[model samples]
Target: MLPQRVRLQYEASVLHPDSLIGCGVRRIPEGSTERYTRWINTITQDQLTTQVYTSHGPTVVMPTWFCSRNWFQRVGPFDEGGKGVPEDLLFFYQSLRRGGGVARVDHCLLVYRYHEKAATHSVLEETIWNLRVDFLQERVLSQWESFTIWNAGKQGRKLYRCLSPANQRKVKAFCDVDENKIQKGFYTYEESKERPKPKIPVLHYKEASSPFIICVKLDMTGGVLEENLNSLQLREGADYFHFN
Candidate 1:
């Protein structure tokens, strides 16, 4: 049976004359692995927006997505990168980029079967990371004059190094709670050929500035990072964006 939530979301999405795309997802995964299920269920709004900038978070499979033919045609023709390509994510990102809106059914009306050898498993982690960074640069960083990167850890440092030189120059600092990182004081760009190279300061999260590009993964810090973020009273999207 089609849940009322799904029906209502569809109705509202299509009722609009302008272009719209919606994902009516069953958050619960049937017969999925515990690790996959846990990660899927724990996805947060910030992480979702950071990942795809969609309100419905990241849909693991296309079966969870529902949209009209017209809207689909407008944003359809999913990336033909084939096999290892994250076609669903790319399409969803494009739809949103073209002024689309997302709403979730939040009910288990569909079943998601997970197994080894799935097409999703074929995609490389680096491919996903590159796509997300590109999207973030195009959508968010382009508008900001300067920003900080949260977490001075490996992931955070990698993000800084990978950013375009123009964007890299805009990184004001790296912030983290790790005493070891904070004690190091600054991150030196050893690869740069500049006479002095470049030194970016590392400070405690409380002392760091925003709007920040958070590289810390969600649900992994036992709420320590979340608590610090909350204490700062910084609004997601505006004051910060997650890259992790």
Candidate 2:
């Protein structure tokens, strides 16, 4: 699935032919008799592809990884944090950063077993959040001059409050389809140390600007949000990005 000039690993267990599927590892428990984990579900190419950027995890388990020796050397070593660290994830991000490619084979090639003593459990949720945010800043926000946040709800506000000061200033406004949020007019940052704080304006989605940093999760709404987004005719990853 790799391009002629691009170095990539092809996975068949979960990818289309001639296309890279960042494969997902099937999670299992040690000494368990179940054929599949409770979470076992069909994974498609679209989900596998987006997981790298959106979820910031190894789309494929490390064991299924296959690449040329030279490419492996270029990608370099995994984090030696030993435990409580997502070394595979770290390496995958690095590979993407280095222009490495990823694809998945549409066949189950590995069984990833988990146990109470497994190191994966040691990684905290907050740690992953911080990493995802950092990666977002590095990969997307840095390239844009400014952007709007697509939601005026708690999640959008939280993202605004958590961003680095420099990135925080880049937020033009928050947009929403919710009438209540739009009627409120503004969001005041009570947590800011500035004497007057910051009161960010909230506007209807139609009036908002793009490129947008969408804080709204996909597939949760009953097509309303998607319809609104589609109406704008903006391109994803260029005119807008998703942080949800």
Candidate 3:
């Protein structure tokens, strides 16, 4: 359990009753889930919403969450489905849909333990991927007429295949730094029943247009990917949203 002062700090930091308040966390055994831990502790305040579509599950780790009872009742009773259900993520998404906000206390208030037997491991990656795609389509993709995907690699192609037929039609290109993928020119949707397979152009990142659904994972590229993106000078939530 957190010390009294930490609890007080969290309570004091609440911006409003409607906010899903979380705090930074330190993982047990030091390096477990290193990238995920860094993401939870370091994302900017605005990224609490903007980065919601990423594979990280939730921008704020669920164990650190606190909220008013009134707000909780409004946004959730949580999914009662047993073991495999991602109740926290489901609740988080519902809260966002109901005009709730997210805020972090910016202090390490929890020691998040990682174990192979944890209930979280019961939840399948594909389950979360499908949920994320649905929410992204509902909240962000519906607003764009066309967009570029920031990777021409596995993750990017998976996102394209996962999108609904209507949203898939909105994909103008897949942009990448890989010369081979760029030289290949286009990605064909071989799964589609349409007589002419849908082909999406694969361009160098500099040649692609925004708004973009970036499928590239941040921090993993040793800043090369970030450098490429920053060069574009595009607004994050508006010009792009990270879906990795």
Report the number of the highest-lDDT candidate.
Answer: 3
* Candidate 2, 13-106: lDDT as tens digits: 1233322233334555554523222212243444444445444355555655766556567878879987778887788778778776666554
lDDT of each: 0.72, 0.68, 0.90
Better of 1 and 2 by lDDT: 1
Q: After superposition, which runs of candidate 2 have C-alpha atoms over 4 Å from their true positions? A: 1-21, 24-51, 59-64, 106-118
Candidate 2's displacement at residue 173, Å, is 0.9
Choose 2 or 3, whichever is better by lDDT.
3
For all predicted structures, in order, the TM-scores are 0.85, 0.74, 0.96
Span of 10 residues, lowest total lDDT, candidate 3: 5-14
Residue-wise C-alpha lDDT for candidate 1, range 30-83, written one tens digit per residue: 545554455444455334444453222353336656677777888769888789
Q: Residue 169, candidate 3: how far off, in angstroms?
A: 0.8
Clashing pairs in 1: none
Error of 1 at 188 (Å): 0.5
Off-target runs (Cα >4 Å) in candidate 1 are 1-9, 15-61
Q: How should the candidates be ordered by lDDT, best one leading?
A: 3, 1, 2
